[model samples]
Target chain A: MPTPLYLATAVAVSAAVTWGLRALPFAVLTPLRSSAVLRYLARQMPTGIMLILALYTLREVRPTAWADVVPTALALAAAIGLHLRTRNAVISVLGATALHVAMSTLWPA
Target chain B: MRGMRARGGARDFAAAAADTASVGLSLFPLGISFGVLVVHAGLTWWWATVFTAVIYAGSLEFLLLGLVASVTPLGQIAVTALLVNLRHVFYALSFPLSRVRPLGRVYATFALTDEAYAMTAGEHARSWSGARILWMQALCQGYWVGGATLGALAGSLIPITLHGLDFALTALFVVLTIDAWRTQRDLPAPLLAAASFALAALLTPGQVLPAAMALFTVSLLIRYALRHRAGSPAPDEHRHPVPAVPAVPAVAAAGGEG
Candidate 1:
């Protein structure tokens, strides 16, 4: 086991670095917020970024197995459908999540 | 006036809390998993608390357990963190940090996770106060930290059958993506995202996320340049009319989208 001092140092380093990474954009973007480039990005990037994030989250869901694909697809459809119908994010997330958890448990893939 | 202000404050708090309930439910289970992992990795429960409180970034915190257990070099940890979280730079492009108070903005910036960004993005966030935003962020952090602490303390008692709870994050992202797509109706955005994911997955499977983001950024810039050359007005120009003399600063407009 590492010494207590070393462990403390590790935690501190991790905290500082993590916090710094989170803070970097804010510091860098404060000055450039008004630039035409950022303006364009502000308007155009949201949809693209959200898309990227959703796909990225599902990157590991290979289609080799029905069990692997079915629950997630169904849950995603449920989420979309509920959101489109209710226009409530909380309901969509919760309802879909409950369905996913139940499906995963029942199917046991 | 004071009574009215207090009531307004209560209303904002309630709204912010209500808005984050789904996220809170999702994060708590994940946080518990993180706590269990930290302890399993040979660290104390307090370490989980520290990680949750100080780092606050979910995926990075998960990775940190292994890094700490292996005693990875600080420089390596810092570099890994920077790459893992590089997407936050993109999030900052449209995050309404400017609307928040200065000191609150600092904390807001620190707490701006993927869930927080997703919750606050699009048209709904435009009318949110700095108070509501800050409150929402604080509640998120609270859920994470509280859950981590609980897991660390009673991790052994928790059953191992909670297999698919992690899907909550993915589901939340899907919902947010749908919301964003509906709000913007920008068809090429999803296509570009797919193209970026394909390129990144094919070329750099290990680093698919960052690679995908970089590819998307480049593709977006190219599309923007093309549109500019074509003299097409911005899609959002109608929603936000530019003043004759520039009354609102660019930063104010930066919060308009993304």
Candidate 2:
């Protein structure tokens, strides 16, 4: 194992950098709170960010070919369908993940 | 503490825990994998808890697993953390930190993980109290830390080795995205996000998130400037959806969201 000092440094640097990024907007925007741009972003950014994040989450699913991408695409369709019908977060997430795992594992590539 | 005389106390903590249960379900498996990976990566079992408890970002922690094992330079590790987490800066824009009190605000900011951001900032949760926000954050960390610790300590015994389990988070965000759409019905915003990502992938494929976010932010700023020029009321404190949280008062509904 690496020394405790080394591990502590790793944790500290990662934590500091991560926390710094999270805190940046809050610090910068605090003074700019009165700015129209800031308010406009508050109205607008959340939805766009959430959409971007959803797409970000899908980054791992790269398309190699048309037919190769069927299962994962089906899983997304399943998730959206379940969510629209039920409006239950738990059901949609679990159902989609279950389909994804089963297809990815059982379906032949 | 004022109007909250009727429905209030530690109940907020419990309610937040319940609020976090769905996401907690996702975190547990991912966290358990992290725990298992930590021990398997030649780190001590306890480091699993240390990473989750301290660094707290999911993808970054996973990246750090490889980095720490390879003895990556500190500067490189810091850069990795910054790049991987740059998306967080955007989260602060709409996060209701202003409504949260001082000490709790600090904790809220510290724990502003993607899951935390989605949970608290979702349309239904706009009126969340400072205490509820804190408790939600604490509970989120608890689920992660707890799962990681369990996985590290008793990993092999758990008998779970599912592939594609990480997709749960993606699925969670998918649901949240749909919910955000249902809430606001903002078609252009989602289209803009897709276009931003598409453009980012076209240009800075390696740094899609930060690049897309920068482009998106600039676009939003342009929209704001145009709207301002068009005389749609300049954004002031009372008019804007204020992000400058007060340093004092208003925990009255601390436990009142029942």
Candidate 3:
């Protein structure tokens, strides 16, 4: 097969898998008519997914970049604060991003 | 929460559809980024657009870009993409969009991006509305389309380096995780994800995120299994009826969808 064909295949397969996984609750719940286990999982799904994603991102940071950590920590704090105070996703994200950019620029290593 | 209105009998499917459209439109930039990346990697813009329109999963899109560039074997790329996106299975499993009309259900499945999933699931907790769910999905797709177009048009116009942008996905995920943990009140979940990610990172360096995600997913499974073995009620036993799914019109959901 041509190389691009390989990528296309990858995209197709990935979409299928994604559909299957994401569709799991629907397929099962529609039949089962409300699964407590599944519901519980759903409740916590965001947290679990986010945690892994966040850690993965942080892990990529060079461990020695203490300066980077400062901005990151600031961003996290800003996000947390904005979320708690305004409970708004857009504002919190923007605020955190702005803070991080400012800090990084001001205190570049 | 000004006009937090609740309608009981007749379902406002049109309203929901409109809402979904707004979400998709807002998210077009995300899709555009993936589109730009795909074309930049030597693929045709049409293919890139088709993929964004079809696949519609952000992280997996980025991963697919890599798999495409390396010219990995078809079978291998397929498996990797499958594994990388395995978490989506869970996303689909518990989404409340299925509660919508069959047509809405079909559309929901097609439009179930991460943002939509988050919004819909949160809304479902309060009241299951086909309109609201549909709106979220549509909006998410909008973002995908917008993002792809922008990326394709201005692939090089934005001189900002792409080096740290990938981290945005990670940061976004982190924020998502934290929010999930805060809302879910389930200790095992956040802990499981963290532990799994840490272990996977140690085991696999470059592929840490995927490996960690897979491991984290397994951790959740194991926790579920252990709970099953013990025959104990899982934490989220009672569905707290959400109060009209407060439309926090502000929280501009961020992160490059791709």
Evaluated at residue A77, the lDDT of candidate 3 is: 80
- How do the candidates rank by TM-score, highest first? 1, 2, 3
TM-score, prediction 3: 0.73
Q: How good is the docking of model 1, by CAPRI class?
A: acceptable
Q: What TM-score would chain B receive for each of the candidates shown? A: 0.86, 0.80, 0.69
Top candidate, metric TM-score: 1
Give the alpha carbon lDDT tens digit for every residue of B23-66 in model 3: 34324434654666766677666666667777787777777777
Best by DockQ: 2
Q: Write the per-residue lDDT of candidate 2 for residues A69-94, one digit (tens) a residue.
A: 77678878988999999988778888
Task: Supply candidate 1's per-residue lDDT for A26.
Answer: 60
For each candidate in the order shown, give its overall lDDT on alpha carbons. 0.75, 0.76, 0.60
TM-score of model 2 relative to the true fold? 0.84
Among residues 3 or more apart in sequence or in different chains, the pairs in candidate 2 whose N, CA or C atoms overlap within 3 Å are B1-B251, B1-B252, B98-B245
The candidates score, on chain A by TM-score, as follows 0.81, 0.79, 0.67
Q: What's the candidate order when arranged by decreasing DockQ?
A: 2, 1, 3
Cα-based lDDT at residue B120, candidate 1 = 76
Per-residue CA lDDT of model 1 for A1-109, tens digit only, reads 6556776776677667656656666656655766676666666666777777777767667778787699989998998899889977778877887888888888887
